[model samples]
Target: MMKHGLDPGDRRRPERLTRPELTARREAMERFLHVATPQLDQLYNLVCLSGCNVLLTDAEGVVLDQRMSEADAAQFRDWGLWQGADWSEAVQGTNGIGTCLVEGRQVTIHRDEHFHTRNIGMSCMDAPIWGPDGKLLAALDVSSARADQTERYNRLISAQVAQTARAIEAVFFRASFPEARIVVASDEGGDAAMLLAVDKDDLAIGATRAARRALGLEREGAIRPRPAADLLGRDDDMSGFDKAERAAVTRALARAGGNVSAAARALGIGRATMYRRMARLGLGEKQP
Candidate 1:
């Protein structure tokens, strides 16, 4: 920060957005707040009595929402932990919120680890929240100015911050594709959520970053729509299962004299599902 002319000894607080500027900034976060605000409340209740403050920031690290104990309000404001404060690494230097956004990972800047000498008394743990497209969206931070807080305690709190961040990312991802079915790709991947959004036809419409990487697709944009089974290496048109299904459907239709509903009932499947299967198998159109 010295190269950028920021002095470690400087005690000035980060710049606060003007009233109108803050208002506009918040209005921009309406959708994000829809998914994050409630979770932040739950997290706040779990940690507020511990003398900590929870701050939610936009991708640029501008504080967008926060929850703090009223009793500790004065000191938190004095430290500039409030709505409109810009804590981007450009201004704050090596802090939890900014660094997490930059690194795309969870981070903890403990007391004395802060770049600004003035901020050295507070401990901050933050995790990056990812958007549906695998881009950095925002940060979730838990900061404590308590004198008795220790590194050991920060580790435990850090896990909560990370978990909540993932929860926000998952919810946002699902909301991004409401019409699709979200499938858990696997349970073994460590924090990075492995999920896939499959449409009604079983095509892969979207995937979480971890799943995209595992499936060898682009990480942050429109994935060329493909059969989920194809991507999973199960798209064998000539496989025994496909042949068997085609034969079964063909025989059911023949037995029912081309009546689709009767064929579906004989196959013990719903009419719509049976129609879909027949269409998928390229079977000739039959009467409903």
Candidate 2:
């Protein structure tokens, strides 16, 4: 293990774990990789190319997958950034991948945020990736020395890695749990707040709790608990099911029905603008 100096106030941290706890986390990751699959390897490769070293950890901060660029890998290894490592702040001190995961958000913990002596030279950015029902899935992290990087680019790179990680998660989820409902929660708003679910065949089912709330529903309205093409203008192909997919949905609904209120509600659209769309689409009587 690498050792370094503990600045004033760093010596008294109670949250730090002993060496054995760290060793346990390290061993767990080794066990996880022993049975790794192709999809997991793909996820690791994609993350590795995204301009940051990526570390996939469990709910606990045990590193499951790690991929760094060859040059960075060498440097990281010199810093003792090996594959089987305990990423938790409690074990290795306050670094981004562990601490951001511990706090459950996208976090940047630069050098001084470290609570232990060994972590003081590293700068890291970590984003928490959540699974269905909002369970923490894994984390995407980038780490380097403070002397070699800048704040703005670091944040931008972290965000990019986070989104890439999320996409990998989406693909994995859709494939593994094909029948289970999948809801995407976006940090983007406006039309970007759109929510749509899919059935086992990947057809549009309906929205979830957050989707209904984002669309301004008082409670879970008529957007059935099952897969239904209740959304008025929704196409048979369901291309309009995402925010980027909405324009097509709106156009299709235009051809299907003219009633704005009727169509909007079905499409997870808010009521106030349903009338406006009805006027725009020149709709007649509402669909039954």
The model with the greatest lDDT is: 1
Residue 121 accuracy (lDDT) in model 1: 87
- Give the best candidate by TM-score: 1
Q: Please write out the lDDT profile of model 1 over residues 1-288, one tens digit for every residue.
A: 865567888888889999999989888878878988888999988888889999999999999999998898998898899899999988888888988888888899998889998898899999988777877789999999798998999999999998898888888888889999888776566645677899866778888777887878888988888777767765455675776688688889999999988999999999989988987788854335
TM-scores across all candidates? 0.83, 0.53
Clash counts per candidate, in order, are: 0, 5
lDDT tens digits, residue span 1-288, model 2: 133342434433224235686566656545333333343455456545444565666666656566677856765665555555556665655677777877877788777676666566667777775543335656766676436566776777666566655554455445544565655534364322135566644445554334555544334334434333433233454343343344544654676575555666677777666655444444433333
Model 1: how far residue 175 lies from native, Å: 0.8
Question: Candidates' lDDT values, in order?
Answer: 0.86, 0.55
